[model samples]
Target: CLEPGTLPEPQLVASFLDLNAPVLARACLLLECAFFVNRCNRGEWPSWMKMNLPLPMQQAEHLTQASSQHIAISISGPAGANSDPID
Candidate 1:
């Protein structure tokens, strides 16, 4: 189960705000990490290795959220700036 009420970091939030991008949100879905584990679990491997997601689903989700949020903000914000966001 995912933790409740755990918001994303402020820097990330600020970036989202600046871009008014809400595609930044994610579905909280987690896939398996076993593929990486299987590749690096050999005893001959070094111990200091680190793991990273082969594909970042969160980033994609965030961008989508950010775009949506940006559009919403543009519509709701003042009507003077050069806005091209889709409503």
Candidate 2:
């Protein structure tokens, strides 16, 4: 269920609606205001209601470096071509 004052105003609503969440199933969502209100009152919002909701999360540089290292290794090949790009 959504807490009181949880949902932002219509302008903020426009922002979320503009997001690209097509990978997250969309058909299941319906614009039923009464149902949403009742579910919020009863604390019964579906788990995925908030799934994929946007928030700031930091990216890890270590993973980036590691993947780059692997690519370097693969591109080096048996001859160890360190100067070559991933061609």
**Top-scoring candidate (TM-score):** 1
lDDT of 2 by residue, 1-87 (tens): 554324435564555556676634222232344456677688776556666454444235656778999998887786565456676
* Per-residue lDDT of 39 in model 1: 47
lDDT by residue for model 1 (4-85), tens: 3223445754465456334424222111123333445553232333333424787899899999999998887666466777
| After superposition, candidate 1 runs with Cα above 4 Å error | 1-55, 78-87
Best model number under lDDT: 2
Give the C-alpha miss distance for residue 27 in model 1, angstroms. 44
> Candidate 2: worst 10 consecutive residues by lDDT?
23-32
TM-score of each: 0.27, 0.23
